[model samples]
Target: MFTGLSAFPLTPVTDHGIDEESFAGLVQRLAAARVDSITALGSTGSYPYLDRAERARAARLAVEHAAATPVIVGIGALRTRDVLELAQDAQDAGASGVLLAPVSYQALTADEVFGLYADVTAELSVPLVVYDNPGTTHFTFTDDLYTRIAELPNVASVKIPGVPADPGAAAERVSALRALLPASVTIGVSGDPLAATGLNAGCHAWYSVVAGTLPEPALAITRAASTGDATAATAESERLQPLWELFARHGSLRVVSAIAETLGLLGHPNLTRPLRGLPDHDRAAVTHVVQQLELH
Candidate 1:
């Protein structure tokens, strides 16, 4: 459940609220592609913007539509009590695991971060993936903190943000982090553009954003890497370099929303208020890239 490719699907919503049908379609698409797992309400899902009920609904929809694939729900919230509630909601929804990042408004000390994990993990019955997404959480975990939190019960995997760009450096970094963590806790790499590099360097899994909307290309890379054909994995990822460049320019959330919209998998104004999809010109660029790359 924690390893290989865990696709993070966007939670498409409308003025009326959760778009249950579209969300289910997204989950089902990933499941049909046989992604290693489905993660609902991750940062890509715009989780922080959704209320408890909405997030709970999204979790349930993901689990229900994901077929036999494992589902991991993101249970991150600003408050510890809320995080616990979300965790319980995910568990009740039958999530195979839960992904948690230490969400906060104020700056949190390392001790506070560690305490957050301790408090939440104590209440969690299912396995927990330590989400180290500094991009959204604004809380960085030191090696010492990772060591401490990973020592707690139910710590199944560590979702590291990304690895170094240079292959040697990436390998050494993952190797050193691997030594710090318990063998039971797998290391999954995020940052879609660097996924191939990280996996070739030693990451056990890829927590991908694009995979949610387009699973075929993602599966190609993951299968290649997992099967020990690192060259094929790198080539496949490089083949999608245009998409990665767009993700760098417009932010993955907006770029992916555009892709889903372009592909007609989601409706207009699908995102919550104040967070619109890409502009017309940018979307035109996306269409050109999608066609040029022949992305389905």
Candidate 2:
């Protein structure tokens, strides 16, 4: 049911706790920009770092700020119960859906992954968007596995990254996946400014971090691409690529979170427990990109 662009609003965490004002501003800006929806607690939100309570609080506040826009919380946890609980919490907080990943610690066989999805889908009332970030999960969903996963009742979409990030290759991958997935299940693309190309290849929507800081430009690119205006979309994407590279340089989470923090946006700069702050060089790189983009 999602289309166009959905900005993954950064979860704001202050040293004390969730920073309501800064966090709200970011969501409100996206809402004002008319982004298709908003996703919270995704990989880019540093989901693994926050405690259960912090995550729920972030979801609740983000939903409130989102107004009529759909709020989908990303549930990436080691425990199925934790994932289910977070999904329930998201539902309770009025989330529109949950984007879930495979179990974190151990890779499961295709059957096991399907069964785990079955468990989570059974417990969640809201729609589930399967998040396939093999880079982090270290497990890629095979075409057959995705076909099976698509049959689950509540599963509505799959978020695949532009892993290799080459326009043509990514398009080929998306096209192949689209052929396998049920028409009802929307395919979402992440990473790279392939929004235009992905849509051309049948991606129903994009989960864009670019939209987080530059909603208008990001959406403009999506709209251009959606309308078959690749020339215009390509131009905007070219402008966005350098900033995206900055994030890529320091890892997605660090650059995205630090960008939010630098802009006086997000709540706390705290990452999940283990991952520390961005190194100074990387932090400066993000600042330079933001400034270069003139993203105020």
Report the lDDT tens digits of candidate 1 across residue range 63-158.
Answer: 899989999999998899999999999999999999999988999999899889999999989999999998888888899999999999999999
**Backbone N/Cα/C clashes per model:** 0, 7
The deviation in Å at residue 220 for candidate 2 is 1.8
Scored by lDDT, the top model is 1
Worst window of 10 by summed lDDT in candidate 2 = 265-274
Clashing pairs in 1: none
Each model's TM-score, in the order given? 0.99, 0.91
Each model's lDDT comes to: 0.93, 0.79
lDDT score of residue 88 within candidate 1: 94
On TM-score, the leading prediction is: 1
**Deviating ranges (above 4 Å) for candidate 2:** 163-169, 266-273
